[model samples]
Target: MMKKSFATLTSVLLGSVVVLSACGSGDSSTGTPAPGGTPSGGASGEKVTVTLAGWTSSADEKELLQQTLNEFEKKNPNIKVNYEVIADQYMDVMKTRLIGGNGPDVFYLDAFEAPGLIQTGVVEPLDGYVTADFDTADFEQPLLAAFQTGGKTYGFPKDFSTLAMFYNKKDFKEAGITNPPKTWEELQDAAKKLTKSENGKVVRYGFGAAPEIARQMYMMKAFGGQVSDDKGSATFASPEALKGLQLVTDMHNVEKTSGEPKEVGAGWTGEMFGQGKASIVFEGNWAIPFLQTNYKDLEYGTAELPTVNGKKGTMAFPVAYVMNKDSKQKDASWKLLSYLTGKEGMKTWTSKGFALPTRKSVAAELGYDKDPLRAAIVAGASYATPWVDKATLPTIMNNFNNQFIEAYSGKAKLEDAMKKAQDTANKEISAAK
Candidate 1:
């Protein structure tokens, strides 16, 4: 699963040594791996155990990953996988282990954190391990690009999710709306019609707005504005960005059609929509299971987000399995990594639908494109902007979210808030440099 909050990489000096024994695996130095990532003795060599580490979001996710590993082990008896759950502070633990030379052979890496980690030279560049049969071209370009830098591949995205509009069917019917909005203007009109007020007091909001940078970055892209420049410094305060962002603030402050989760006493947009406090919300594939488990009676449907300025856009979150550069079992690890992210392996991993496959062939084989609820999500992947930038993204996101809420809550002008947020983020980036 993708990280809920952006975590910045803390620079750690590489000279310090912290000896920690990797668990669940035998000595890995017993085997001499063959060229092109094949285990020694052509499948039945001196056994090597490769460690794969990641933080699991749910028991189901952990079990599914174990099941996938089991299959891999059955295929390659020589390479046993030691699946390790980092449990908490995954990145911090990973960074420490990597610097101390005790990191797992292969580990999970979110697209957001890939750039920063790769820059430290801890993640193995995966291009040399790739062969023609790996079908690297099958992966979604945008998702793959997140783990790439300077024309070299660092990791392969295992899966991805894109934002989609989740609307309550009952609310739509009651408001006499037949279909989802196709444009920003239509969404505003529909939001006004769907908003409910009783006795001059606002009851249910028409839309649940997530006013954070993660959600608003795509909005900025609707105009010509971008999150950063070529140098990775913040540049989101331009007039073009405010043009799209003002639309959100105006809906909440002026039209009063939309409100954030906090205003409705909810913790998140998903909870706000599930509680019937908001008629619509932008969510991803992860919300489906949450709604199913928490609000089984809620009748909701998903659609691709409304187009902005004649262009369709949304944000994508992807995570990959990256090999540790210092891994002694590089060949064995590549075998496991290739299989897990391969078409067949990916299909088995994504069969339960808890996650969406990043491989185009796997997605098509699963028929998510035809499913009523997932079709919109599948459609968005083509045009979705990845929730990834340079190493400065975490700093940029924190400053932007802190100030953007002021504008969303009508406490500050959109232009002023964005200018402050951008200037503050850039200054921090410069100081860090």
Candidate 2:
């Protein structure tokens, strides 16, 4: 989804209902007063209420957030958090509310979308509120750097995700592979051996490629390719970038070991790996909980994404908590932001295993420092590249991916596809600007 500020109309509707309900219940405990206002826990002051909206609706995440908020209330006694769940297609819904001036005070912002929202001047900068003690240094540099504009930081990273190689243990054993591949050559060899065929039909593929922008970003980085120039202009036409695209296309066209999503009729690599149709796949840490809960019997293990030409690299997709620029409760929002993204809250949220914390201290505190899966993700952070470019990247990426698929399917050469994408992306970026 393209990142844009949400229209606040729906939020206004939702907020009205919440306010009316809070009033009718006559429970002062349900709401807190706005920042700089009188304490709401006593009879003399009015209650203040702040709304939080995000795309996550997992029962566990909601409960954990509620528990955290309850603790926040207990400490402050003057603040109450009214959490709202934004359904799927959150960007559309959020854009409406933001444009309508009724958006939530605080919301989750993906790095991909953050640049666009910041461009619209909808997000508030947090540098003024941040103190030296907030330990901005504790965050992974790349993650913390994503939310900055003109040398000023605007958001606090809540969680991060990085790609890793998830291999099917059973498939490897059947293929006579005793260990996972450690280098690109080993990976290619294993993939060739693991591919199974029966009666002229492939029973299981060695790998699966989902031709999405994010996956390609990691692949591009693997070959030391720069997706965007230093000035944030499209540069996929460069030799390094084409080399990355060539690697992905070769897996399908040249090696014949990897199949595209369309060929397998599988929606994504994660699903293909879970079904045992693919021996190895690259996916985010979020897949951990999904496999644990849904594919309970699947024997799988994760390793660092294999090096490209002997160099290890991956992409980091981090989402941060960004406050509305027009929010009236700035101080209150900052407090909640710090607490939610702080070491304590990060530990609680990441412990659920859906994501990796962006905070180095939190990861260490949660024992991810030693956990193999978590360590792979954490280790990639240093070399990880952001998933966005300057403001016009979303449009550029969309056009690039649509054409890049042709190369992945062997319909076109990698150089031709990438050159076309580069030209098209440059035009789009120029037009948008």
Q: How accurate locally, in lDDT, is each candidate?
A: 0.83, 0.73
Runs in model 2 lying further than 4 Å from the true structure: 1-47, 222-224, 230-232
Off by over 4 Å in 1: 1-44
Q: For residues 1-433, what per-residue lDDT tens digits would candidate 1 score against the true structure?
A: 3222232111111122234466322363544554434233324467778888776667788799889999999998877888877665667788888988788989989877888899899888889889999998889888898899999999999888898999999999999999999899999999999999999977899998988888888898999988998899999999898888988899999999999887879877888899999999998887888899989999989999999988899989888999887777777888899999999789989988888998888899999988888889888887889988998998998999999999999999889999999999998999999
Please give each candidate's TM-score. 0.93, 0.87
The CA lDDT at 344 in model 2 is: 79
Report the lDDT tens digits of candidate 2 across residue range 156-194.
Answer: 888877777889989899889998898877888999988
Which 10 successive residues of model 2 have the least lDDT summed?
1-10
